[model samples]
Target: MRQLFGNRAFVLLMVSDFMQNIGIWIRNMALLFFIMEKSNHDPVAVSLLTVIEYVPIFVISMIGGVLADRWRPKRTMIWGDVLSFLSILLILFVVLAGYWQAVFAVTLVSAVVSQFSQPSSMKIIKRCLPDEHVPAATALSQTLMSLFIILGPMVGTTIYQTFGLLASLISLLVLFAASAIVLTFLPSSVDQAPDTTESAGSLLKDMKAGFSYIASSRLLKVLLVVYVVLALGSGLVQPLDIFVITERLQLDMSSVQWFTALEGLGMLIGGLIAAVIAGKVKGTYLLFAGLSFLGLSTFVEVLSQWPMLTGTMRFLTGVLMAMAQTVLMAVMMQQVDEKFIGRLGGVMMPVFTGMMLIGSGFTGWYMSATSIVVVYFTAGALFLLSSFISMKLPISREPVQEEAEAPVSVNATVKV
Candidate 1:
């Protein structure tokens, strides 16, 4: 752990993530409640916020990879944060002018910018760290995410309720600005190869190759299917999450933060546990157990009438999901070609987000027609399907050692 933190580039990236994740949570809760108030807690309006959030990602994921590949990773990340800061600033003003509907734009802009910054982060982790450090890096990243998951809603709600939307927006702006500044301290790009925009056809060609590569690789193909199914499941439940509080628990809408915070708390502890057992566990088993039980947990969560039971299930889901993700990263690191890893992320992200977008789009209407419980029940079923499919994946415990691998060309590394 000491040695891992000793790497300056890694540290800077973590700091940037911390700041940005904090900002995201603040925006998520603050904007969420603000919109709920303006729209009278309409499910469609909230779901629309989700749909808008994913549109840019589904549109940009493949294209962002090409850009991330062409641009310096460090520069790409910094610019992504900067653009996010500026966009949030613009929306903050628009909100102040009484165009409260523009609040959804905040989620949309942040999600779009993240499509770039996120891929760049993966590239940086791949480049700066040695193979041995990957697990530790994964643990540290997930831990940070878990911490924020536990804290973001509470903090975002406190700020939003106490100081109002303006203050929350300002908080977001400052946090993003801080994150951008932190990223600026990251080391210069180690791979400063020239940009790969040779011609319009080159990008299309590379994208074609990326898809072809995934299709040819059975492991990658199975992973994509698992991801797409899980994404759709999660998305179906996400837009209706607040109702678990409003209708189920019979609590105020703002009380939904507690619901999420419990899940985050579970993840926080789960991160620690997963880190401990990561080396001892087979990555594939962890993936299967996590998703399988995660589905069961979600299935159980909506069925319970007690708030404590609901929170417990949420916490369990958090732990399982975090563990699942930690090992899933291991599986990817073990399975995917290193050169192709960046492209793999570029490819997988859009596919997952696209499916999530599909599920999220109709979930609002579905919930209106039925109830929140049915929506989550269906989501759980999808996850179970994903889990069953994941069982077909070939097992391997080795991590990819990039140094020993053969190289692919700049044209192939076309995405950021």
Candidate 2:
């Protein structure tokens, strides 16, 4: 961990990102609760609010990625943070004024505005880290982000329960402001201006090229397909777990909250393990092993009815999921070139987001009509199938040639 933090710029970026994630998670939890309260605890209305928050990402994330590639990443991220902060302030005002409908609209707009930042952040991380350190850095980032998941809900619930909805919104705004401040420290060199030569192409042509690149690469396509499958399978777990705990096991909301926290804790531990073992292990092997564990854990979860066993299985599943995700991301980052990273990210963002959206909707509908146990069994089966599909991909065991390059000082490296 000390070696990983030796790069001051990466450390600063991680700190800012940690704060931003915490704020995002807190706002999300509070928003769900607020919507429930305002609608007289209507489950359908709360679900609608959740849908509104994520729908924009599916609609606009591709454009966000394109803009990230065309503009400077640092500027893009700073502006995104600024817009998000302003949106939060507006939401805060509306909440304070008791205009619940207006708050919902503003929240949806905030979600749209925030989508612009993800590609730029992803590109920056790809550019800044050396090939050898990329896996470890990815693991560190995932660990920090997961750690926030444990705290954010607890803090948000406490604040909402104690103060009010307005306070929760204000807290998010403060965190966004802090994120913007930290982003400002990044050097101008990190931002890559759009290429004049590429400016002549039509939008459709450019988008096609991006898709073509991903399709032509065997490893990239396989990774993407496996991700989609995993996303679809994992989606069933959320609603199924909720039903099992609330309807079958008779656990209250507080217990559910704590169970979620335990899942986050497991992810944190898994990420830390990845970071510690990063350079010593092959990313492909780690990913494969993790996915296998995830499949087995899901099966265990589906069979277990006791609260203790269910919680343990959920925690183990989270750990394996985190390990798989971190390793896959690190491997993909190493495979792609720096110049096209943004465009590649743009192509991936929409696909991944769309898959999750589809998965959520499908799983929600399926669980509504069928038994929770059936849903879990289906999810576990899909996971096992995805693991088998993943094994068919040809992931290279050798490190990329760039991993042998001499380390450059942070001062000398371009920011973008």
What local distance difference test score does each model get?
Answer: 0.77, 0.74
Best candidate according to TM-score: 2
Q: Where is the poorest 10-residue window by lDDT in model 1? A: 400-409
List runs of model 1 lying over 4 Å from the truth.
30-48, 92-110, 189-191, 194-201, 235-259, 302-310, 357-382, 395-416
Model 1 lDDT per residue over 1-416, tens place: 77778999898888889888888888888878987999999999988986787687668778777666566778888898899898888888888798887767666777877877776787788778776666667876888888976677779899999999889889888988898898878877644544456433376766665666676667777888899999999889887788777777788898887878888888888787887776677667777888998889878877777888888888888888888888777666656654455567788877877788789888999988997878888999998898889888875544323332223232444323
Error of 2 at 393 (Å): 3.5
Q: Per-residue alpha-carbon lDDT of model 2 for 63-170, expressed as tens digits?
A: 565556556788888988899899888887787787887877888888887777877777777666677888888898888878877887777788888987777787
| Leading candidate by lDDT | 1
Deviation in Å, model 2, residue 374 alpha carbon: 3.9
